[model samples]
Target chain A: MNTFMGYERPNGDIGIRNHLLIIPTVICSNQVCSRIMQLVPGTVAIPHQHGCSQIGADKERTFEVLAGTGKNPNVGGVIVISLGCEVVDPYALADDIRKTGKPVEVFDIQSVGGSVKAIKHGTELARRMLEELERQPKVPIPLSRLKVAVKCGGSDATSGLASNPALGAAADALIAAGGTVVIGETTEIIGAEHVLAQRCATPDTAERLYHIVGRFEREVERMGADMRGGNPSPGNIEGGLSTIEEKSLGCISKCGKAPIKGVIEYAERLPEGGLYFMDSPGNDIECVSGMAAGGVHIVCFTTGRGTPTGAAVVPVIKITGNKRMYDRMEDNMDVDVSAMLEGAMSLESAGERIWQEILEIADGKWTKSETLGHQEFSINRIGPSL
Target chain B: MKQQIADGVDALIMDNRDHVATVLREIMSGDTVRYRDDHGIREITAIDLIPFGHKIAIEVLDTGDDVCKYGEIIGRACFAILVGQHVHVHNIEGIRGRGDRAGKAGT
Candidate 1:
């Protein structure tokens, strides 16, 4: 079938999961939000460390990510909680989300008297929002409205050889079906960006692609450190990735052979269908979080060393190429393409298997990460605290 | 197709022009490591112990030469590397995105 079950949003976007997301606008509101989530059923809360004492780009990122997560079509309603005196404006955040035409309610901890009172007030708000969301009927969403992010973490050599190529094939299939595909982790694009540049659909995209890469490299250089200090991270080196280029070459394969239509900044909303690249950190949680905030409905993650990471607002499907790691971390992994390395399975067959899994997930099948409750969230911050 | 394990094509050369092959299994010194690429299945002897998933040099590389994998330059060789030797962080250095070595290795 070319369509999946989803809820129609008033903003004209289709959401596969009708999540009532509890957003903490600042660190002081996290405990209250968490309490409300526990007190009310069918609620998810995102607890973050920033939103206080942050200045300039750092503070702006926290606001943009929080607001974008609230605007994500996957979320049907939102409850924004604040600490009253943080740098990020809670009411402003609520206003940003309201622009999406979704139901959003905002309140601050200081005005509500304290944590206990705040939790009580937030729980009541959540329960009512969730009830309203439950009344929304599920409708069919075409593949054209679906956007999936391709990410890789804890990569080993086999990632480049097996699972990534398999995922690349699946990515191509998704785009062929009129779906949108996004690939991020600009940190992984260091050496082989030339290959991506050559595949850009326009000169503008190629320039933007080069601009982001060059900017990241200059920043890393300004810090007086090498990308090697953290990249091809110890786990990656142990798993057989020797250099940034080798790791990046493997990393890029998961996005397939589609021409990049655009290169967007972190947390920026995506354009309509075809392939796009988001300039995001290579850190797993940060990259996935950025993509989720950018309106991706699902994340197709490839790992070689294995990770249990998921996203707070979107479903993350874990695909691996290491047979031993998959067997060891079977509970965390959903698809295993290691047979391609053994020559037991063709690349196309392995890719088809992943493609089928993506379809099933879009139809409401829970991913291993979702089933295991791996809702990991992180925001990429530039600049520093005041 | 099912003869992979028994046939001893235990390693892979992702591209035919790559200078190294990734061993699918641990290889003891002097063991014949078999691999397949565009040229089909080929064999080389490991002169040093290579761990599983690590690289085994398929070509001789001198210091300052590019270490090729996936048919692209992964790093620059800091030390001499012989055919069948282990190629890793100890012998190869990443040449991009560093400020300490700025103005060197452009492109």
Candidate 2:
């Protein structure tokens, strides 16, 4: 239990996987990145629709998220693809990830000749990086080296009782082992923000928690609608939730009972350890993408109703507490804690089960998401697409 | 502690001393239900028809008194409430300094 095998980076970051990633800094370079991924068997690429015409925080958020994703411990090396001039600076992003001591290569479509030349160049660089990554061997690392993001999507009544709390217990275990655990979805904290604030380790942390909640609320209101009517999602309502507050209260359980160490902005690199909160939207894909982009090595996602969502790089471990849903979506699920309701399993036992699954996943086992090829990626957008 | 019940179809945290429990089955006026306090489950008859997961006022609470759930006040009753009536947004108002969601708890 003390150590799980992982690939160690030169910067001292331990990676669960030694994946060589091809990151496209702009939408224009997505095809090139994807082509590179297709050519290189072990390489992964995330094609997002942002990085152009975005200004201020939105543009900065893109750069930070993309850089963080590349720097995630799961990636042993990275190759960044860019269009030479975009809102996000590819060199700066490369520099940011290079600090992790991993091999980083940057190529621009305009700088490297043209589209045909860029694709060829990007593929060659990706192939070299993949070969270099393949040379690195995994070593046994302490459990404390792990950092996990806890999430829930497609929730139902059973989510609170089963999967969320079960994941929370696993989160608590990770924190106890001196590892870092982060929980996000600021919008889901709406009606329940106060309760979480009280658990903050410091007054400032508590204030920041509320500040993020307020900002999301005000921003949503500016769009001329309330969050309650829409926050639950049509599926959530049909599953039995009534209001945003109702949904928020249940969503908070995935974090477990750890002290809220701090609140961070969306896509920001997580401060090393303990439980931190990432300010993010509740939209499942965006939420998972933000966590993946923020350097989370893996994500423990809970659901009552199911979703087949995954990330382009980070492995998403799907956990469900609903027995029926688990049975129906067995192909999509990784772990099931539904036995707790039947008195066949203790909550702690269920948590330990999930923790074991996480360890196995971190050790390079493919999750149901990965096996099924569910690499769904999307960036939360702001401003107009110009 | 007198126990308040979370009514309606959604799950809820009723008392700060008691864990928020989901409503598995619906109840009607005069139907007897059991609620747990610090000691154990106490049986009480519904004063009015109550849906699943919606809260029922357990003790006399004034406006702004923190409504407890998951063993903490999730929000405050927006208005006064009798001992055995439904507690929800219609009656429960948010205390709102830094509490987690308003009514739902134990998630």
| Sliding window of 10 residues with minimal summed lDDT for model 1 chain A | A220-229
Q: What are the runs in model 2 whose C-alpha is more than 4 Å off?
A: B1-21, B25-107
lDDT of 1 by residue, A24-86 (tens): 988889999989988987789999888999988888998989998999999999999999999
Error of 1 at A132 (Å): 1.4
Tens digits of per-residue lDDT, candidate 2, A1-386, equal: 68888888888888887778888889999998888788778788889888888888778778877888888888888988899888888899999999888889988999799888988888788777777778788789998878899999988766766678789889999999999999999888887888899999999999999888888776765655434446677676555554566667778888989899999877888888899999888888888888887788899999888898888778899999778778999999999997765546777888999999998998779999999878787887766666
lDDT of 2: 0.77
Structural similarity to truth (TM-score) of each candidate: 0.97, 0.84
Model 1 residue runs over 4 Å out of place are: B1-7, B103-107
Candidate 2 residue B47 C-alpha distance from true site, Å = 12
Q: For residues B1-107, what per-residue lDDT tens digits would candidate 1 score against the true structure?
A: 11232345867776777899889888999999888765567888999999889999999999999988878889999899999999999899888877777766654
Looking at model 1, residue A151 earns an lDDT score of 94
Q: lDDT of all the models against the reference?
A: 0.89, 0.77
Candidate 2: Cα lDDT at B107 = 18
